[model samples]
Target: MTRRRPPRHASADELLTELGRLTQQALERAELQKARVELAEALQRELLPAELPELPGLRAAARYAPARHGLNIGGDWYDGFPLPDGSLAFSIGDVQGHDVEAAAFMGQVRIGLRAVAATAADPGQVLSRANDLLLSMDTRLFATCSFLRFDPATRELSHARAGHVPWVWATPDGRWGLGEDEGGLPLGVLAEESYPVTRRVLPASCAFVLVTDGVIEGPAFPITAGLDEVARVTRAGVHAEPAELAAAVIKVADLTGHADDAAVLVLRHDRPPA
Candidate 1:
């Protein structure tokens, strides 16, 4: 019969040395993580527009906040630009995860939308083409977005959604409501999915609010409640400047202790000079 040797115990010096090595490794890993986060944040900032476009009758503003609990970088994004046909385009979206990959995918989605919007017939077609573009990429990430094209000449706004939170709109007279439009599957979900467009004329001195889900959803806060808070704030600020209203809307995330990244885009049609 073979007898097993007595188990050997690590000496005090060896134990201390091992602990030191582990501590160094942990520090190295932490530094690496920090560097990655910084890189991701820089990338995100580069991708997001520096300012929302301003048109003759339309005033636009947007605000973005990183997650309060997790990594400071995320996939929430918003953009505003003018189409070739003289219409203004605005979009806000959230990619699947809150990591570097998600940020990269967000850039891709934004580029796709901009590329397709040039020739796309409407908001629905724009989202559909963007969806197809994402599926063509060699990636598994998905995204949700709300897109709008506003024609300054006609005061018409066409909106489309892809599994995104509904927008909140308010008129100067204290009327407000949620978008509640029919939406399609998120980008990269189904190859054949098609988003539907909803159109309406803007009333004078009215505002439309678009937000990523993070702005209105959290561990302890329900989206419905958050949305109601946004509506109330918007109703009160319908006559305020787009920038002020956007700032107020984004403040709800902090007030509600929302842990995820948030973004708010406010579009307002100012009343013509009397």
Candidate 2:
């Protein structure tokens, strides 16, 4: 006699309960992740300048690329704003971490540094003050930054670097070299240390390139090779305007496998000879 198969268990309520719990958990996780992403993106946007500062008699352009590897954007940032003395204040920096908190801290440091730079008029002093500010704050992040006070009249670039990548300059004659700035310490580090400012007399038709370490520190190439590529690209675009040159350099950097967040700012001196 064929035994009647035990009636299939029909616990629809129990099944529905399990499914509801799973769905609720999934929704909660999705909401948390979305909130985190939004927070990180907002912080990054706040850290960067909304628009490049207006400078009379000079043309400037910038390119920023966030890394493609994570939920939180990296800390690379570029900024340009007019100093109270009428000179252009230009800078690029990267905090050590990449997250919402890092971005927020970076925004605070960037604004504070700009104010300090305006008042101090000395890059080293400004950085020192920024370090003190960082130490006083709850955030314990560090960053490498380069600051330049550009004079359109004399084509002089007064610059200082705090553990950031060295800048490059391409003269009108096609000669290219690093813009070497002397002693400096990264912000949010030792308060007693100071940075040395270096001045460069750019050619009337020169192009100066500033960048963050993300362009040069990733895999597939060493930092030196990345710099060499930059030098090459700057020479190739020697005849282009600052904005055009910056675009070209950014393209080349991306092609060379810059997998991290990267930024480039180009300054082209075009004042007619007085």
Candidate 3:
């Protein structure tokens, strides 16, 4: 005798129960996603220095603003600390992506650089060690960084860039120029490479400006004239306070789209806050 087959159609109560179960699962997943995003952002902020250092004969200020607030936290970090030899070190960098993983990676690189810099103080060497750290993680991501170490007694500032954005330097005589020089590869691009450190005796009352990509670029926003605008703005306010100078420079950039995060750090020599 052939056995009767089970019913093909589910009862209304069974269907309702399944639907409720699915709805609960979806709600739980959404909440988990939100929590993850918040945690990542908090971690990113911790990586950056809360304020610039207070150094003799030197004034500094920095700001880090997310182009748009939310889960899209770009990998931008800025730091300033005094070395054992009574010198000050400033660094700004951007990791490859504007996602959670990039932000997390940024923290690790930032801390590693700081730990190595305290002993090395050579921007190039510090970055070389930091690069090794990144490669060891095997994250398949890279970062662009600019490091500046200033000597208070000599009034000299040494810098190194690893495929990072160009920094602006304004002389006391109102001349402004980009600090672009021959350098090595960016971090994570290769397992081994060396970066060159460029040094100069900064003129008294001079100012240097460091910025991330967001300040120099945006979504189709006057790309051809960005440098000219930056020069003009920086030249006019070369003598402003570090904080004011950073704000003024950023105010003029085409930050309309809020497409990428922006970071600005200003170093002023013998210039009092205004």
Candidate 4:
């Protein structure tokens, strides 16, 4: 005790060395986070569709813009595929959270949907099976999704919602409308949740738009404002091709900070052969 253990102090060089080691660890962590983000972006590009499916009597286009805010890479997703039952299926969804976990889960959910669509004839039934599939996955996350089944031959469409936004429809004949699909609880929340199928007869040259909540309820843009803006721009772009129409709708959103990701999938009903 008298010696005092040389004041129980560390050498200057030793302290400096420890500081350096800590700084190195911090740098390593930063690098790891960056790598993860890059990986997520690449995975998203692979997972998301580069082009919409080719369906009869419909011109389809889609756009996916990731969020610009912190860790904005998230679970927003859209899919358009042809079912074996001779109908075109389109869906848009957002899983909870905005991290790599959510993105990975989104991939799983989308794959489940595509597989279930093959046999399920009704949009509501498709969603019900998808919900059960998701529940079985045991992921501790929920998602909102909207599914639509369109029969191009009869100009008929059926929509199902799982706590998702309604589709916006703008007609070439100067008619603007919104889907009447009823919303149920989000998927993975309840095993017995039932989605209602709402059917409508779409008119010729109608641009039907599907979007996530982020697309309509951003920090700067309220839902009503965003809806009005999208509807107006979509109507104005009604004569444009599907690709241009999607771009126009996105631009009209005027996204800033990208606090949340946005996806727009549009299927324009083409006039039948003369």
Q: Deviation in angstroms for 98 in model 1?
A: 1.4
For model 4, residues 174-197, the per-residue Cα lDDT tens digits are 988777568788999999789988
TM-score of model 1 relative to the true fold? 0.93
lDDT of 1 by residue, 92-128 (tens): 9999888888888889999999999999849999999
The candidate, 1 or 2, that scores higher on lDDT is: 1
Candidate 4 local distance difference test against the native: 0.82
Q: What is candidate 2's lDDT per residue for 1-274, written digit by digit as tens? A: 8888888885999899999999999999988877876787777876687778755556788987777655536577888888777778888888888777777777887898888887987677777787788878856789888888887666677888888888888876868898766857788787767888888676667778888777766667777887888888898887787778887777755655666677899887766645
Global lDDT of each candidate: 0.88, 0.78, 0.80, 0.82
Q: Number of backbone collisions per candidate, in order?
A: 0, 0, 0, 0
True-structure Cα RMSD, model 1: 1.9
**Against the true structure, whose TM-score is highest?**
1
The total of clashing pairs for model 2 equals 0
Alpha carbon lDDT at 70, candidate 1:
47
Models 1 onward score TM values of 0.93, 0.84, 0.82, 0.88
- After best superposition, candidate 2 residue 83: deviation in angstroms? 1.5
* Candidates' RMSD to native: 1.9, 4.7, 4.5, 3.0
Clash pairs of candidate 2? none
Tens-digit lDDT track for model 3 on 115-220? 9898898888988888888888888789999988988777788888889877877866868888787677888888778999898887657888888777777667
